[model samples]
Target: MSLLQSQVPGNLRLRSIDGTERLVGYSPPTRQNHGVAAVVGFEEQELLRDIKRALLRGVLIVGGGSLLALGMTLLVARRFIAAPTDALLQAARRWRAGDLAARAPGAARHSEFGQLAGAFNRMAVALQQREEELRHHAQLLEDRVADRTQALREANARLEAEILERRNTQTALLQAQKLQAVGQLAGGIAHDFNNVLQAVLGGVALIAKRAGDPAAVARLTGMVEEAAQRGQSITRRLLAFSRREELRADRLDVGALLVGLREVLAATLGAAIRVEVEAPPALPPVFADRGQLETVLVNLATNARDAMEKGGRLTLLAEPVTVAAGDPGGLATGDYIRVTVADTGAGMDAETLARAGEPFFTTKPVGRGTGLGLAMARSFAEGSGGRMTIASKPGCGTRITLWLPAMAVAAEPAAPVPAPRPGALPARCARVLLVDDEPVVREVLATQLADAGYKVTEAGDGAAALALLAGGLACDILVSDLAMEGIDGVTLIREARRARPALPAILVTGYAGDAAALAVGQRVEGSFTLLRKPVTGAQLADQVAALLGWRETV
Candidate 1:
């Protein structure tokens, strides 16, 4: 290599020394001009430069050692910085990938970095705990919803059943109302009819009782008696519907009534079943509407008869009861006269028994029975302040008890009123007041009483009757219809009592039920009598004569 080439790549000028270091002239190499000649001087100075280089090497040794130490520190710092950061980055990546189980670096080479890693670990744990809490809460919410849904379903079913039952009950009540209306109408018309029949028979009886012509009297008497008997039958049926008769409200010795009815009861039930009556002697009498009581009896008897299709013994029993269980067929406990009718026959289950008192539930084939008998009997009993109960099992027999409330004391038997003395008919000379709403009924009653020889005064309304009485009209007997438009019979009765307290009064009405009859009967402190509708001349005379103390005759 030439002098310029022989130099180190970056060395431009050479330093020369002659036992002392010195700067020489710098040379720039020309393309081909300079050769090894220029380097001779530089070469000669190399030995001297070698000595200077050795001296410089000794001076730089300490700094070089320091620099080596600094380089080692920097290498360690880079490794530490990258290690924690890499770990934190890797942990974050796992957390972000939905891995809650990943744990962040908690221990670190440096204090500050260790805390940061710990914070990351804490945050990850908190997130995992929150997720678990959310899952558990959601499960509880689902369970609650399921429970509520089931409860709602049960409530809906119960409500539907109640609604259906209410509908059936409503239908039955309406039918009962209709049937009651029909019965009331029938009873109202029958009273007048009975009166007319009584008059016809009484006049015929008068003629037949005394005539000497046996053949003619016998023929006429036979016709009249037969007609009267038929009339009596019709009246009996009407009374059954109206719940009225010659009611003698005594301590009803129920045992006696049942015993007396034995023969007839057996025939009614037929030879298939044995009808039995068991009554403790000296059983207390029940204070009740006798006709209504009989209706209950007949209804229960018939029900027992129907229950024993294959021939079974039916027992009719009576016991003087002092007190009973609470809620006996929804009746409160009380002192009662218990009449029991039991049948050893095909029994009823709960479902059938529940519908027993419904107006029209019949197990018999259609037209074989009308279902009103039991309902009417129950209504009558209830109206008379009594109750009834039924007990039965699936295969066992049925027992029904009539619970009749007892009176404070057993009433003494009433003395029978004597019949009119022979040919001692009352002087029909009294002036009478007749008040009624129905014009035809008023005319009929007035004509009958007039034919019997009484001076009859007629008024179509209560106010007219009251006005006539207030005007000092001479009146011996006051006859008034119970129900009227302006002033009813009750108001008129009060006014009449105020007008003349000793005035003889009689009330005629279409309604003769225990409730209605009691309403009037309770007001009988004075001499007031009630004659049910459809009164005849003879009954009219009988009641009037009884009230006014006039002579009575056939």
Candidate 2:
């Protein structure tokens, strides 16, 4: 191998021979055509040993330089990025844990970390401000709620007080209204009563002056009787208007009623207003209470007179009418007597007309009107199964119409005449027990009974009468006045009846209602009679005589 290697030049080759590696170099001749070569050979491991050592040195130096660069990078990252990141994370954690004051440490620097930290801090300040504002709003709301609750409580208390006061005021107003109505009625009554009293007084004075002259005395006495009758009529009218008297509905001739009311209307309306009544004689009779109808007519006449302040014509007319079912006037389907009272005077407006029949609604000045006139008239007409209507317009006068149910003519049974006894013998005188609380009344009644040929025993009161009866005083008839202080007439008569079951009794009372009630009871017992006062002495005598089966003398 050595001899062959000397032939090559500038060329080396590695060869493996006998499990050993060798390096071989070849050097060729300078000329291309020369075949001469030089060769050199060495072990391959020995030649590669120095080259491997140089490569190991280069690797060690490079590894050390890379490690130093890595260390520097780590240190710079820890100082510039990691520390700030850790601070931001810590601040975020603290803030999440409810530490609102916590801030990132790098916020003062001008780096990106500083900018992030500054933004985060700004967000925290905004959140804190929002939370405080919410708390302040909540506190204000709670305060307003409490204040509103207290205000409501006070208002409720004030409302209750106002209600109570209003109720009391209403009660007082109602009482005042009643008083006003009563005062108006009393004024009219006083005017009428004064005239009656004057007549009575004049007659009494004339009778006293002409006592010796029989004709003059008789005339004066008649005048006095007439005046007393007038007073009685006034009282009955007053009772009817006040609704104290019971209703006595009967068939009434509308024409006659209107004719009779003409004089009264003229007097009530004064001489200024001209009054006219036009009633058809053939008009059907109406079924209504006579007194109530009179009252209604009087009320209408007065209202017309008041409306005619400038003295206008007042006219009253009545006619027969027939109505069908569901009539516009709301009257029954039957014949009716339509009575109208019209006045050519200042009229009512629509509002006034609508409320014309409402009670306590008056157009007249406070003291001049009761306001119940039209209301009462309407009530009476409706109560009698009829209807009342009013028509009026401003400056067009007023007309009031009443539709009263017509009554069919019924045949009245002839009054039975008492049979004359055989030979017309005088009846036996009756013993009468007269009981009254007033001495003058008792004495006058006793004298009347005596003049009628009756044996009379007088007692001042029901108690005295009972005492006399219990003492066995013989009496065929018991006459007693109701409303006594002790043992009233009703009790006295009841006790007397127990002792004398067949004893005839006459109950005299000033109160018509009491007399009516007693009359109902007496009708059931057939042994008692009732007499309403303003009863004359002659009337009492006649009643006593009738009770005793005595014929009245001419």
Candidate 3:
């Protein structure tokens, strides 16, 4: 297409057709058939005049407006669709490549373009926020891992420490058992040997002065006496170990004992440590073995002294108390003599406290503590039908209480002291039947009776003794063993009484006697006299003479 120039004023030509000269009015014609050729016709002048007005007026204006509108619509459509589509593609690529800073132009003319801009802006903002959140989350995860690793390390360390502690505990326990075995052997050996030494010492002391120069005799006597004295001390400690000493249960003012023991506690603990005896006056009387109670006090005092190397306070307090029912110590509600030995020493933690009552448990270095102290005290306290308790905390003080339950009966008057030596023996010497399981024991007593000119019969066991007595063997005394395999001493006494109603019976046993014969008249449930074993020949003579009324002329 080409534009052509025409003679018409103010007209430009758009050329079109091949090799043809054409004039253009640069406008549309009103008449449908009118063309550029009509402008040259003189006879058709009226038609041309009409055509000119149409081209110069309405058609020209309308056709120019239509083309202008079409151009503007295309421009706007491209801007709205194409520009935004390119921006979205770029933004998506940047986001996938991990750049949250990527942004697109958001300015627009129309609402469609405006809405797309708004959505893109919001997407950018959300992406920025999510990126920050992801970074923070990663940091948090790293911190958590670090913390968990540290905790695991601490847990492993603790478990290792616990295992080592258990191993040490086991070693200590085995050592304690070894020491206990040694203690038992030493106690048994000492108990038997001490008696033999005592007899020797007594006989030697009786006669040494008659045979030597005064100085020599005095020196010899002193040496022998010292040996015997040391021997006695050894016996005492051994008997303590055996827990078979003479226990005389007396109504004792334990509060007073605490008061008295306090001074000794001070001496033991030294002036650096404070000693307090909290025992108020009028603490209930505790039926306890006084010697054993003293032993317990000394042991506790010694333990407290050892506990506080840096010197802390020691307190011994005895208070009358009623234990609550179902209390932690398993004590019942009743009058109790609560003897507490407390120390402001570095106390044990819970683990040690749990095993405190186990025999021979000690925190002290070897030889510093026998570990028998607590065990012996616990045994003696329980022997009187009472309980012992311990309460302690790490870095805090330890308080051990001996809870002794006493009989609640009002004090009864002392019964007439039955003379241990039977009142003058029955008027005449009667056929006396002696029964004992131990051959050495029966021989010892029978020799005395026969030597004293009384006919005596002996039997080894309950069955033999009963047979002889039942077969019409005339006997005045039925002396039987308390502990035998087939029938015990109490049973023997009952059977003999049934067999011979008039016969006097004596239940004798080695278990009944203390080292001292002070226990001659022990009668449990009171049917026969309980004569302790190892009675002196003289004591046997005295008892037999009193029973028969005839002096034993041995």
Candidate 2, residues 1-554, lDDT tens digits: the string is 44343443454556565767787766654456366666577888898999999999999999999999999999999999899899889988998998877777777889999999999999888877887899899999999999999999999999999999866755556566567546645665677678889999999999999999999999989989998897786676566656677768877888987886674555556668888989876676877898788888877887887888889899999988889889776666888888999999899998999899998688887446657789998998888888889999988899999888898877789999787554432434667889999898888888877877878889998778878989989877789898899788888888887877777788898775674565655533445777888798888877776666642332
Tell me the lDDT of model 3 at 530: 56
Sort order, TM-score high to low = 2, 1, 3
Can you give the TM-score per candidate against the true fold?
A: 0.44, 0.60, 0.39
Which parts of model 2 have CA positions greater than 4 angstroms off? Answer: 1-181, 248-284, 289-302, 311-316, 324-333, 349-380, 420-428, 516-526, 550-554
* Model 3 regions more than 4 Å off: 1-171, 174-286, 289-298, 301-363, 366-428, 450-454, 484-491, 494-498, 512-526, 537-554
C-alpha RMSD between model 3 and the true structure:
26.3
Better candidate by TM-score, 1 or 2: 2
Each candidate's number of clashing pairs is: 4, 15, 9
What's model 3's lDDT at 362?
A: 75
- Of 1 and 2, which scores higher on lDDT? 2
Please give the lDDT score at residue 204 for candidate 2: 91
Where model 1 places Cα greater than 4 Å from the true spot, the runs are 1-135, 143-151, 154-251, 255-283, 287-299, 308-429, 436-455, 459-472, 484-504, 513-529, 533-554
RMSD, every candidate, angstroms: 26.5, 25.6, 26.3
Worst 10 residues of 2 by lDDT: 2-11
Error of 2 at 13 (Å): 99
